[model samples]
Target: MVIFGLTAVVVVGGGAFVAKRSYDNSKIVPTPITPEDFGKIALGDLYAPDPKADAYKAAAVTAYKKDKLKNARKGVAALDWIEIKDKGPGGDGFPQANFPPGSNPSPGSNKGVAKTMLSSFGFGAEQWGCLEKLWMKESGWNERAMNRYSGAYGIPQSLPGSKMASAGSDWQTNAATQIKWGLGYIKGRYGTPCGAWGHSQAKGWY
Candidate 1:
């Protein structure tokens, strides 16, 4: 996930090359990746594949989409879990659903989940209005967004959605999960949805 105040400068030159290589080594894109495959998934690899990203992304998206389609109705109902108004200090969940990992929920799911999650955090539409436009413009709400050049990926276009875990552990295709982290990011850095929206409008990021 993108952090505040800076554009990514992939520092792979000179001495950083070794470190970069090490980081690269942690990535692994699995083929025929089943939902079972996710248990062992390297979220880093899934979000930012290596040189063969085109093919890898296609397969990843296909597999994930199929999985969602299979559980579409159930996942749709899962939206019920997202309640508005932060459930206090630890929030709705702690080390569990509070922050899942690399699971990119469908864009439509993301919206529904956001509404639910944000509401749970004591927020109303006034807080979400600008954010709605920010991502609508960035990915058109596409959870699988991948920049051909920069390789930014997923709903938040986290460049490498793996970084989203820092907001919590949930990173899969769970929109409520992603929205939780995204809202946290906005609050931590910019303090409000409209603030983050303004920054993105001015600097091409949010």
Candidate 2:
């Protein structure tokens, strides 16, 4: 009985070894890389050899003052799953590293201004919704957009929405003229196409 038990142990051990070897040989080693690994590649092997040190780091300091500068304020919003796609491989490559996704993209969100405009214009969800898309594409609501060629100008790409003179002459830098012409344009032809607004969504114009 002892000899039989010893024999069984050897057989089991041998079987396990064979199975492991076959499994190892059959498995395909994956060359796929993780975001961290890819990021390391991005900087070049020389920059961050020691992950712990992250040797190439910016030292923090206070009282920063500069003469010329451009800046924007970001907002804190719960990102939807779609944002993840934009931040990951699904997004056109992770957002420039360190910079978090959905960082306040502009100096201020247009939400409030848009809301006010909607109320003033008596625009319903669908109509103003179209207007919103138009401005977003026009000048990002710049309020100072100027076209070099056709000489179209202002936030709403007033074109000659400047003709909004009938509304009020401040048409040059007037958000009101721009908005008025934009609204009128939509009402006239598209009757709320967001005219170029819808044009922009379809062909990135307006």
Candidate 3:
């Protein structure tokens, strides 16, 4: 009886040892990340800072302050996505003429104002590029920009110019008013600056 009991104990211990070894071998080991993996990853996947993007943001903030623009109390609703593409057509063709005689020129004058207005409408910093490109193409960010061909006028390029009156009585002179109207128009029509920019990209107007 003692010999039989010893044999039974040995068999059970052997089985448990084999089972544990099998289980250990079956466990998954994670792969280590390599420097090459960064190259394989998507640009959007990396949280790396971009100097050029930061510069653009900084310029936008400066332009806003220069124009003495104020932020609206409201912000945009949650957006599902914002698409930004292309380096954008620079406002080269827009005339260098200054508005209000002594005011700053187009393109440079309204950068921060546009950014602020877009933010009030609930857009992210990523959308600033698209907005800059969109308005650059539209009116060159000049408050006095007048489209003789389409009868569009101001920074937002309101058709007939007077249409911006709903935003403020000083839409013709105030960059903030024009921007406010433009933001409202973009929100109403395209849902966001990126959306308006996308439409402008595809159809040549937003």
Tell me the TM-score of each prediction against the true structure. Answer: 0.47, 0.40, 0.50
Tens digit of per-residue lDDT, candidate 1, span 21-103: 23553353323435543443434223232334333333333333333454675665211111121111111122212323444
Q: Please provide, for model 3 over 67-186, each residue's C-alpha lDDT reduced to its tens digit, 9 standing for 90 to 100.
A: 222222234342111112111111212112233655554466578877766667888899888888888876777776654323356776665455565675566677887888888777
Candidate 2 weakest lDDT stretch, 10 residues? 58-67
**Per-residue lDDT of model 2, residues 4-109, tens digit only:** 4433433444334234433643353434446765554344331212221111010000000010111112333421111111211111121112224444233134
Q: What is the Cα-based lDDT of residue 93 in candidate 3?
A: 20
Enumerate residue pairs that collide in model 2.
74-104, 158-161, 194-197, 200-205
As a whole number from 0 to 100, the lDDT of residue 132 in candidate 1 is: 82
Kindly provide the TM-score of model 2 when superposed on the true structure, using C-alpha atoms. Answer: 0.40
Worst 10 contiguous positions by lDDT, candidate 3? 80-89
lDDT of 2 at 93: 26
- Can you give the lDDT of residue 55 in candidate 3? 35
